[model samples]
Target: MATAYRQTHDHPKEYFVETDTDTEDSDFDDFVCSDSGKSLDATIFADLEQLFQSQGSEKNDQPGKLLCEVQTEENIAEIFAEIRKEYKPTEAEWRVSNIDERKDHEAASLLDDAFESVSSEVEKSGSIEGCSSCAESVNVLDVSQFKKGQHISMPGKFGTIYQHHAIVCDVKSTSGTKAELELIHFENKDKSIRIRKGIKTYDLKNKQIYLKHYKKQRYDCQLIVSRAETILEDFKMSKFKKYNFLLLNCEHFATWCVNGEEECFQVQGALQMMVDTLTSALGIGSRVVKVVQQLVIMSTDEIAKTISSAIVPEIVLGATAGVYLLYCLAKTAYLKMAYKKNNLCLTCLKITLKEMWLGFLVFSSTSVVQLLIYTFAVPAIGSGVGIPLVVLSVLLSVALKMSVNTFLRVLRNPFGKEKTKLSRPSQLSIADIVAFSYYRLEHVAIVTDILDVNERAQTARVRCIHYGLPKLLAKRQIVEEEFEMNLVNSSWHKFDVDDTTSYACEKRLSRARERVGEKRWSKTNRSDNFCHWAVVPIARWDNYAFEEVNDKEKKNKSVEPFFNKYPGYIAEELRLGDVVDYKETGVLVRKQSKVDQGKNVVEIDLIITSFWKGERKTYTIDLKRDDIHVMYYKPALCISMQDRVERALYWEGRRNRLLWTTNGFIESCILKEEYLDN
Candidate 1:
């Protein structure tokens, strides 16, 4: 059996070796020198002796002090040369076994050099308080002292990386007086990094490592140190990247409870006291000011840490978390600006859906690979054994995964009755999917509806054939691959003109003319219902005439007729209450048109209206296009027939009507002569 040997000091400059064999002529004789008949060990005894003695339980015994006192520049050169001599023509087994040791030595040397440089610079700058209860202008860091590198990995659990550079910068007391500042340059570009200053003062008389940290105005360094030490009581190794216990705020409910209105009052008083203390120390007018200042400083370092910590997390979460936060902020800002100008929430769900689908495709594949590795390779390597546990492991893993998914789903929608949840890469809501479907279907419907009626119209045909169908088809084709084909088919063509009872009657009996491929239009034409006579009524008598004239070019031109007046109508200056037949309708003139159009004079007619008085109603005012009141032109006022038609159709559909039509005509009832004066 291989036996563990105690670290022992032998020849100070020579290597130390230990053997478990009772007799000298054992297999370990290979380590023995053939000529001297003595074992040639590979390690130095003096170096180990000094290290073990310095770290021993004794007053005034520190690793750095002992190392510095024993190992000088000459000593380091000799030790390194000796190590190289022993390792030369390196044995394969020794090389493999001592890789970590060699790395540690190399890293220590580099760190020592770096600290020496730092010490030289500090000596030139100012003197620092030493551990001897003496103020000395000495280089704090000696090259031969430190035997380890600051660059280290945080042990246990998460594969987090950390590097710490601390060599006791300054000591502080209960009084807010700090001796020196220790700064570590963390590689981070994020502006939100937080910085926290630690105290490094040692009590030489007490031989204790004194800690100093602030709490409000009065620095409660002792309290912080005591609490931290208490938490890490059992941890012997108090070093960076070591697995040591730490105190955490486990009272989440307490915070929430104090934030309430009733408890907030009590908290406010306590906060006031804390604030007052900080205000005095920071020399700020209010508690808020002091807090903000401290927070700003703290955040400098914290943000850097956060940036560093997030570097690996970004790999797992992808750029989505960061990008999403920025996107939301930007969108919110834009929405606010646009809201001030009266804009709508026009975020296209179609674009969002497309991106989600693509993202899902990539994420799903990655998740499968991750699942396989975690389930198979990870366990095998970590356990250092292989067995026929694949079937049982897979089932257990899948079941646990499925349970987790179910829990998440239940959390999201508590009221839902669904069970046996399976996780999807793209967590799209039913609402989102429906909205996307509706948007696509509406566009398709518009194209199909147009093709149903006005397929021959060049603009309509071109729009459906060239632009509309191509865009709709592209979306359709992509979506079909994503979703089921039956769902798309049914959603796009919701209304059935087939055996559907009432709608079937509405459908044309005779075969509709099929203009496009498989796309047909209604052969049965409905009543024109144009109301041309009512819309642009012909005037029985010409009352007023005017024309737009260019000031730059003076030319004689015939002015247009007012109130749909016929050219053959004898031009006459009409007065109030004059009866005039215009096309199919009779108009009672209450007032004449405005008698001004550039250089040419025009007349106005006031038609009769219900607003007119009994006897005086006979005289109506009819306004011409030139005599119309000029006001601000709003783009919103330009509502097309399509919008009105849609609203009418919506209302009609709510009433369950097969078909509904609107007469596009606006009646401006006014007596002909009513516009004379008033």
Candidate 2:
């Protein structure tokens, strides 16, 4: 009967191989007869001949030949259709497993009725399972007893192998088993992670098959299994890799009596095979199909933030290991050069060991992290284990311990010891130079890595830095604002004269006050709008040192304008009568004056020819020695100066030396009152 069935139905050559044993064939025949010769079909017979013909070819093609034209979707559908038509369900006995015995017995009666109905359908003419077979006994396994295994496939991105799995403990849902098995095959075909090795099956009590998977990491495994449902749905809809988005997969139990090999038996193909079959079924252009494949392969499920948070540290550490290689190279060079004399110097040895140790930590941590992620975190957490909780628990233990140990010494002494120590610069030995260069390169790479992670802002900053002068010059307001009032004031010097003091006394007293202020401000008074001055925040400069201002040492002095007492002004010409005429004018006005707390201060107003008259007239003025050579500056200077003065605003606010400057100017020109506004 087996031989005849093989001849009659185009079962694959491999399926027929078992039939070669005549004794077994007879047994199978008896089973079939008792089941009403349901397996016999004229169409299957024709396909069997084709399988036989193909089998005569190369040994290697045996599987393919067995699969030959008989492997087609149409043929399998027809075969299943025939089987459904012939095998009336009522004729056979069926039972449910993993359920209470009493309930099972009750359910068995329902199952018997269902089988009887299907048996009647088989006795009739048409194919498709009868309504009775589809009804009451839809599922044979009682799912309550089973623990589901994980989904086997992962949405992948960045060339990493993503995989997942779960355990099946309840009476296994046959359909769910097919899904799991299909995923195992899918992983087997994934070339990215060297998963070419075929599945290894474990022989259980029944003829059930299981696959042992090698996962790159726990997280990858978890991610895959969690999204199994989405993946299978995607397969069904022919939208496996529709977009460059996260792939979602999930798992659930359902009935499965249909044979996996049957084409109409839709659910049991791996992602890769799905792609292949889809391409074949659609008969679309290869290019279009290829595009689809790329999308599916790249589709990845978004890991939960909690999972990602747990996962990122491993990635970071891995990246850090890459960075530490640069450090190692630097250290190697140092050992070869400067430390060559005492190759075994304890300090050098310690440094070498320290660096190597750090490198190992980085690498080992990364690898282990990836492993844990794929093996446990992803799968276990994804299976409702609460990933965040698990991650936190793990981090508080290992990460915390490592961090403390690594940072202990550095935290202990951030600065030098009490004793002063002179440091010798390591001459630019070849090793030193190499180490420095390596360090710089690695540092740049690290910076770039960070920037890549924060693409938008960093990219803009890089562009700005690239343009250099344009950004600086175009930002006039910014440049102007950057001016340090203190720096300008420190660079400029001026003398103040009092009514009771002579020139020599004023100069002497001014110098004395400047010296006194120097101790407080720790800076010199310079000119306003000095182009040479750079308004750099000491902290930002990397080269500046911080100093605290001494308030008690602040000088008590007042600035007396040199032009106050004998303020002189030049003449300007006016064309009031159609003729240019000379007029002696006092353009400078005493806008206001005030003295507060023994500090003398004065405000003078001036109308520059350019300000009051655009290049029409000019003024040349001199000041008396006692009046002082005080200069009236713009408000910007005063504002900036006040800001610095409030807190000795140095780069680090070291001293009470806050001064600033402004370029806007007003001339001390003289004009006749006749030309002035009434």
Top candidate (TM-score)? 2
Q: All candidates' lDDT scores? A: 0.25, 0.25
What C-alpha lDDT does candidate 2 achieve relative to the native structure? 0.25
Model 2 lDDT per residue over 535-555, tens place: 111011111112222334221
Per-residue lDDT over 1-678 for candidate 1, one digit per residue giving the tens place of the 0 to 100 score: 001111110112222235444353223412332223344232322333333354344432232221332213443443344334433424553343333345435433533442343333433432211111110121111112111111111111222121122222222232111122332211123542222224333211111111111011111223223223322332222211132122111111111111110011123335434533332222212222322333343448766454433333224334433443454456456444432221211121222233333333333343344335434554455422322233344344334433543443333311111121212212221111111134343221111122122212211211111011225344211011122222212322211111321212112211111111221111111011111111122222212211222234221111111222222111232323233433212233333334333212234332222212111122222222112221111111112223322332233213221111111111112211111112
- Per-candidate Cα RMSD to the true structure, in Å, reads 38.0, 37.2
Question: Which whole-number lDDT from 0 to 100 does residue 405 have in model 2?
Answer: 37
The parts of candidate 2 lying over 4 Å away from their true place are 1-323, 341-345, 381-383, 389-678
Q: Could you tell me which 10 consecutive residues in candidate 2 have the lowest summed lDDT?
A: 442-451
